[model samples]
Target: MSQSDADAIDEGVLADARAEASVAPVPKGSLWRDRNFLTMWSGQALSQFGAQITELAIPVLAVLLLDATEFEVGVLTAANVAAFLLIGLPAGAWIDRMRKRHVMIWADGVRALALATLPLLWWAGALQMWHVFAVALVMGIATVFFDVSYQSIIPSLVRPGQIAEANGKLQSTYELANIAGPGLGGWLIGVLTAPFAILATVGTYLASLVALMLTRDHEERRAPEDHAPILREIGEGLRFVFTERLLRRIVGYTATGNFFNTLATTLLPIFLLRDLGLSPASMGLIFSLGAIGGFVGAIATPHIVRRIGEARAIPISAIAMSVGAALLPVAALVPALAFPLLVAQSFTASFTVLLYNITQVTFRQRITPPRLLGRMNASVRFVVWGVMPLAALLSGALGTWFGVVPTLWIAAGGELLACLFVVLAPFWTMRELPDAHSASR
Candidate 1:
């Protein structure tokens, strides 16, 4: 599809989403009050929290146990995120053709099987770096399917007016998982080896898969005649993301932020272990503090939105993100205050991220058409998340040459530059929600 054709389709889809938002409303209720939404949310939350544990565990395994180089650790991280760059768009296209619930269920099952392999391989004394890479790749691929389907399903499950509230609840659980999962994973790694500690993650995935199976919903059906060639289909998604004024601006801002943030995170473990001289338990404690901040941020989002409005909330969050990034390198200079600095950074970072995510996601859902939700989400994700591997690679190389502390300083500076994106975008000044009826017209 040409760019113009894609734009036309997106406009049409946005019209449909607005139409749905204006009518076909569900009753106002707690997401917990809906059995199906609760089940789905619970399963996804378990899986997401488990993934957070592995995020810390995998790097700790390579560094602490194997004495891997910074470059090698970077490669491992890259392997995990590479799928988002390579498979995200295709997964979105595929998801658009199938039942989203089935996609999520299968994704959970695949991740469970992959995580289970890690512990078994370790027990057999056959675990190698390549095995880790392979598992990372598989899990990353599964995540693409899971995330795309998950986003596509949200509007179907809740009333339009309740989307923000629903998102806040989901973010709160996710933050709680972040609070518990990494802290526990770090503690587990302290007692058990990193490999065995991963068993908890495997168990979490299994629970998620079971939960997905038990949740029931009406299956979605796509139009038979809507199918197109692979290249054309991919082009359509890309076109919608890049050509649409609102989506394009969002994609640019988020992609830029993620690129710099990933750079900082990729070097964080190295900095903590080498420069700050923190133990695994302490590292976990710091991350747990951040998660607590995230939890508070999630709970506070609705109030923040009501007070400042979504438009103001975005820039405020961006400023918070900048401040958090800037504080990371400062932690190195004050070694005695390392943990405290990290706690502060994590708190602000988590809070800012949740607020930004809830606002953007809710706005996108309100504006996007149901039929195009999967592809649109995938397109945005492909652009925003695809930069992670490159960021990891660059950060690793920088750490290898300049040392972790210096690299952190550079990454933080880069993150501060990301604030310019919001300042320059049209979204910065736009605060009011578009009326569903007017948007549809």
Candidate 2:
């Protein structure tokens, strides 16, 4: 569809999120009082913490145990996120026709099962690089469905105005998981080995599954007769995201950031472990300390948004994050200061990311109609996340050809350039979001 057609559709679809503010029942008291929201929150907290384990342990497994090369490590990492590019759009359309809660449950179960195989393979002395790649691929696919469903589920559990708060609460816990999970995961790797650490992740997912099974969702499941052609539905989703000027700019900035960020991270294990000689335990500590910034950012976002306004918050945070990213290459320059520099970089970068994500995600959730929530979230993820696999592969190739340090320098420069997308836009001139009612009119 053309931009003009998308603009026309935008008008009809924008209706205070279909009069959500006017018609939806606002719950009394705090979101803390809501059982469904709590259930979802607790379940996700466990899963998030568990995920941190795999994030650290998997790469450590490949590099330390499997003796994988730079390019091979990149391929393994790429496998984990490649599914976002593969099935992201169709997953959204398929999910819209089903219960989101059920999707979450199934996705969790699938991940748990996939992760369980790694330890079993290791115990049997049959673990291979292909097995690791296959598991990563499967888990990545499941994560795509779970994440889209997860974000879409929030608006149903809370009021429109509460979305920022809901997201803030969720992000806070996720950051908390980041702080603790890596440390524990690293320790687990030290004690239990990488494959065994994955067992802990499996248990956490099972716990999450139980919680999700009990949580009530308020989704307005579409009847089979109400569904459009899958391709048409996917197009509508893509149009909805791109036709909106602000969303488009945000997508551009995020995609660019993800591309460069993944490029650097795909080779970080080689640089930190091999070049600088940091142990997995030390690496985990640095990650945990750095994540403290994210926790603070999540808590501080509402106050910052209130003071500066959400529109201005986006670009401001984007600029700040790019500044933080500059430290990545700087760490390469001073080997003695590398550990502290990396920690500082992670802290500053993570903080601003939480600031940027919470504000933008809340804006997307509030403006989008409930029916389009899943597809909208998926479409956004498709664009933003799709670059990661390519970045991983490119990082591997660049690391092989140009060396890890030089590639990191390139990654840092590219991240800084990404900020221009948001900064050059009209966000600086605006203070508040356009109300959905006002936007449609």
Candidate 3:
């Protein structure tokens, strides 16, 4: 149960993943040609797009239908991710004990049922702000487990060298979901109701569940063990993340980025709908421009890292986020160019985000051993994603006190300051990731 003792046990468990990888290597053909990869990709893509629907629809629902205040919108946003802060640590610990694929399947099913409540309540004329908040809370819990398991499962499916390409292909979903999901959700909210738009999301989860059910996983099911205590296991993961030289700095840097990123995400829709006088469909349209930027970014990641290196790529994106956020307030001061400025802001920020995400996620997977992936990912998510709710709450309060524009400006400053994290951290000295073989050694 002690740290050294747990590490000794973990060494043996991790060999199972590497052996599985060697026995069932990723296809020599294109990843798309790999049947299991394709099935998994389809499910992930569907589920991601479904989740994207809520990002636009639920926020719009609160603002447009409920006439929620800035603080209330923040609360709504916070409610969705609060589970990450509340249960993230334990969930990560628990998931490491199970077959990740099974966890992912169950996660999708539970999520679908939880999301169905909003529309059902609305149709009966019984929907309240609390109902929406509650559903988001439940959905968040499901997402936390799914994402933890999902990230852990990826390393087992492919050779270590292929992690970048695999992550690149997976990230393509962000672009698709961002562009299509919001655009459709906005239009659906225009033609139908926001509640009805969410119904499509439920279907996507079902589709994902089915796809995952059929896909064959390479990692052998974990054999029964004299399991370590939960707290000890959790501590080991945290230690691995924080004490590992490369991972610790990345975690710290991203934690700051997540906090600042929340400010931009929490405020942008409010700014668009309230002050700029844009409709939900129009806002979604502008948002898609960002996704287009993201699409380009995903495709460009390999080339960018090859050209400039991950160290620069990470900070470059962080600095770009700061700059992108600052421009929105400047654009708003001019009446004629606000729409175009908003589009520009979203596009630039999104593009940089993809650069950071693809590079860092690939790096994380490559550096981490297969056995510790769940706990390591959870530790990172808990530190990085855990900041979202707190940031949202602060953004909401700032908006309530000083109004949306000033609040945005304040957030912009916070984001810009966060860029200092990468400059000061140990990552700037590092260039390439270590080999996966090094992990076992």
Question: Higher-TM-score candidate among 1 and 2?
Answer: 2
Candidate 3's residue-wise lDDT over 45-164, tens digit each? Answer: 888777877778888888887788998888888988898899988986677678888998998999899889888887898888888888888889888788767766766776664554
The TM-score ranking, best first, is 2, 3, 1
- The residue pairs found clashing in candidate 3 are none
Q: Which of the numbered candidates is closest to the native, going by highest lDDT?
A: 2
Instruction: Tell me how far the alpha carbon of residue 54 in candidate 1 is from the true structure, in angstroms, after superposition.
Output: 1.8
lDDT of 2: 0.81
Every model's TM-score: 0.83, 0.85, 0.83
> How far out, in Å, is residue 409 in model 1?
1.2
Index of the highest-TM-score prediction:
2
**Predicted candidate 2 versus true structure: per-residue lDDT over 1-441, tens digit per residue:** 000101111221233334554555454447888787888888888999999989999898888888888888889879998998999779867887888889999999999999999989988999999999999999999988887677567666776755555665776687578799889888998898888888878999999999998887677889889888999888888998988888788889988988988898898888878878888888888889987887687689999999999999999988888777778778878989999999998888778887887777767767777778657866877888888899999998998899888998898899889889999988898898775555332
Give me the displacement of residue 169 in model 3, in angstroms: 5.0
> What local lDDT does model 1 show for residue 164?
50
What is the Å distance of residue 394 in model 3 from its true position? Answer: 1.7
**Clash number for each model:** 0, 0, 0
Worst 10 residues of 1 by lDDT: 1-10
